[model samples]
Target: MNLKGVRTGIAAACAVVSLGAASSAAAQGQCSRDTLDDIAAKYVEGQKQGSIFTLPVGEWVDYRENGQLVSTATGVISQPSDFDWHLALVDTGTCHVLVHGVILKPVPYVVTTQLAWTFNGLGQIRSTVVREGDANFDAKKTYAYASKEDWSEIPAGKRDTRQALLALANAYLDRAGGGAADVALAPSCDRIDNGAYSTNCEPAPGAAFVDREFTVDEAKGAVAVVSNRGEAEGPQDSRIFRIEDGKIRHVHAVTPSQ
Candidate 1:
């Protein structure tokens, strides 16, 4: 299946709106960096103690209850960004659980809604959460079997801090080129999102190509200033900031290429 076709529908617009809501919620929480750090530390501790069957989005947990060793419930550790966290309990004798939550960090930009883990007979953790998020914000909580191949898809090593920002720029370029389908490769992306631009651009397959040159500006937390020289449906030049994540968070256009 072409993931692009599915993603093209509202991925770009929703990403922007969701991010905005998240930012608003983060502001409302008034959670200081210290608070986030404390939470992170606590999560690490839970992992060390092996009590946390699964922790996703820097918060939230799913574990087996004591005694019966057949039921599971999810605990919310942080305020919801958009809506209250959702959980689905699965029964497999041992019980498998999934937790959904968001991680609102300055660096690693993550929005999780689906995370899975397994519990042992004694209600101890048997595995880590798999599939951190879903296409939509809905949480997927079920004890589905995960193959070895599933685990392999999990991202390894530290993510490129400049990815999200780069993606935003590339998204803009993709629109300028035509739509989401035009862009073949993942571009670096940062924070922020396209507004009207995101909606108007229809997904046109193989519309444009991007040749990017990046420089890390030390003064800006090693911010990546990207320049895109390419032809979408037409020629275009755009400047984008690269935030650390898998998707483009923000974008700006210097000259109209299409």
Candidate 2:
């Protein structure tokens, strides 16, 4: 299932709310990049230890100064889609929040099973938005909780990071081949062939061309797929994919410019 689109819509809503709100107090000092780095390091360690993998409830202090609301973080994670991670962050000082992440499942339904943070206290998350495979989303209806039994039933192969990467690539290829518009391909698929663009092929006036290459590093469990095509004119460039999934499902892509 593709959830990136839905996650993106929610992230955008969080941004609007964060920007509209006023900060409760000014930040005494800016958070150092090193501080963020340390926090990330610990976060990774916690994940590895399986100690901090569960989501938090109510309010929590992600960053603190004497525990006085220096900053707060709230977020949600989704599963079974293109977005491996979707996150939004709000700087309480300026009430500014930014959203970023990767999409893993991109077709039939986009799924963004990642994390997003909001700090301005204006950002709120409704995890029960809808069930994992529900085609329609009704705001008035409450979401049914996903039981542990349901989660355990998901096949391990479906949760494999490498498989997820390939699935995402194939989905993008399908979209490109289908003449779908506005769909972004991975940057790894972007390459030029003798002044000819590749990947993201669309039906041309006289000819239909689609061609590309992919490289998957098993050691690193990283996959890079590039698509390119040549027509009567020259060539067209496309996208790339950068995936990180080990045990639990996590996949993302970096655009050509990124």
Candidate 3:
């Protein structure tokens, strides 16, 4: 099946998902860093049990799946199943979490999915975006980055400041696009492009990023940046950088479909 065609069809079903009208007063600044982690866990557990309605949600929840809008009562929630998330990067500052792994459901075929869940200060979920694709779309397979022992934490001597991490990640793009002559990369630097393994850090001409936006999680030692670079060319490209020992160890990229 043509995954691009499939994605297009889904995108046509765009609709906004809202729980209801906002309460007379909304909860503000109630979520802490640890609270975000709890919310993430609840999201995963709720999905696994096919009971997302039980979770705490804001008065208005905007959801998009595969570039298409989805409601709480439909899509993945409708066909609830088990999910094995390999890598999860949580940005506590922004209250956003990005997770990638395979969804184990018998009916619709097993596939890998990248999901970003955003939260509000009221301790409620505000937005969710999911991109689903089959194994063909997942190059590095699942858990390539998460399986590494030191992926979740950056040691004291290895941690880079937020500014430095952003620069290093951007430098990688510059070097990849030939704007820079040198870029720092770990000896075993590996890149997972759209769920597949790729030798992107090698000496070769690669696509340049455009309209880039970045978010850094210092505590997590991770950075999430998205831009337009692939053939489709929009804001659909995303890369998560795992910086370790002052070098980029792994990069998980989700590029747009052509």
- Top candidate on lDDT is 3
lDDT of 1 at 251: 34
True lDDT of residue 156, candidate 2: 46
Clashes of each: 23, 38, 6
lDDT of each: 0.28, 0.29, 0.52
Worst 10 residues of 3 by lDDT: 1-10
Give candidates' CA RMSD values in order.
19.8, 17.0, 7.3
Which lDDT tens digits does candidate 1 get at residues 1-258?
Answer: 001111112234444543454355356544333333333343443433433322222122222211111222232222122212211222221122222222222211122111121111111221111122312211221211111001111133534433443455456555655574333222422221211233222234444545443332211212222223343223323232323334333332223222
Give each model a TM-score.
Answer: 0.22, 0.22, 0.67
Positional deviation of 20 in candidate 1, in angstroms?
Answer: 29
lDDT of 3 at 6: 16
The best-first sequence of candidates by lDDT reads 3, 2, 1
Candidate 3 Cα errors over 4 Å, as ranges: 1-31, 107-140, 144-149, 174-178, 198-200, 203-208, 211-213, 230-235, 256-258
